[model samples]
Target: MSGIPDNLVGLHKHVKQFREKNDETLFEELELFIEEEKVRRKLVLERPGELFFFYKEDYIVVTEELSKIPLTAEEFTGSSSLLRQLNEDQIDMVGQLTKELVILRSMRMWGSYLSC
Candidate 1:
């Protein structure tokens, strides 16, 4: 999915408004924006009346007729530890790929010398 939904386009405008209005109630203002997005999701998503719920079974379940309300903050929060680990892994892989490419190029050069 895209980074941000189209309905949230007004968020930028709101930010501008907040700046103009000198509103220090940042959390409350942002909460309103989040609620608006949630309502938008209800309108745009299928089975508008339904919601996903986590049960004692250690698995999440989605049911009809709004079994539970989902918390967007909890669901959307990123694990800093997980993200850092992933970035470290990616750096290691890129280093290995670079080393392999250098070795392959050197091997080709060595073979060319031997064939001369």
Candidate 2:
């Protein structure tokens, strides 16, 4: 009944082994894996320092006017040691703030044109 492929006998065996060793069901491990993946994906975009809009940006009319310039991870003001100290959620929040700052900077450059 599970979505795991029938052909993946090795995978099934591994799951069984893990279950027996840990006394945790395969479904429980799968759920934990999925949750961890979700957090990982949310914390870091496709590329380091990349900005992706997960939802519609209704608050800003010129939402589509994002800077095409790519930002490097090294460009972030946060030091690597300091960044390492933050949790996944905090890292995500930092990424969001970095994206917003870039957008705001771009808007300032074109504010006069949009005002008309």
Predicted model with the maximum TM-score: 2
* Model 2 lDDT per residue over 15-115, tens place: 53364545446557667656655654655554555444322122221222243322334544534443343333254333333333334335443343223
RMSD of 1: 21.3
Query: For each candidate, what TM-score against the reference?
Result: 0.21, 0.25
Q: State in Å the error of residue 47, model 2.
A: 8.4
Off by over 4 Å in 1: 1-23, 47-116
Any idea what lDDT model 1 has?
A: 0.39
How high is the CA lDDT of each candidate model?
A: 0.39, 0.41
For candidate 1, write residues 16-65 as lDDT tens digits. Answer: 53673444465465666566556545544755544333111122224532
Q: Which pairs clash in the backbone of model 2?
A: none
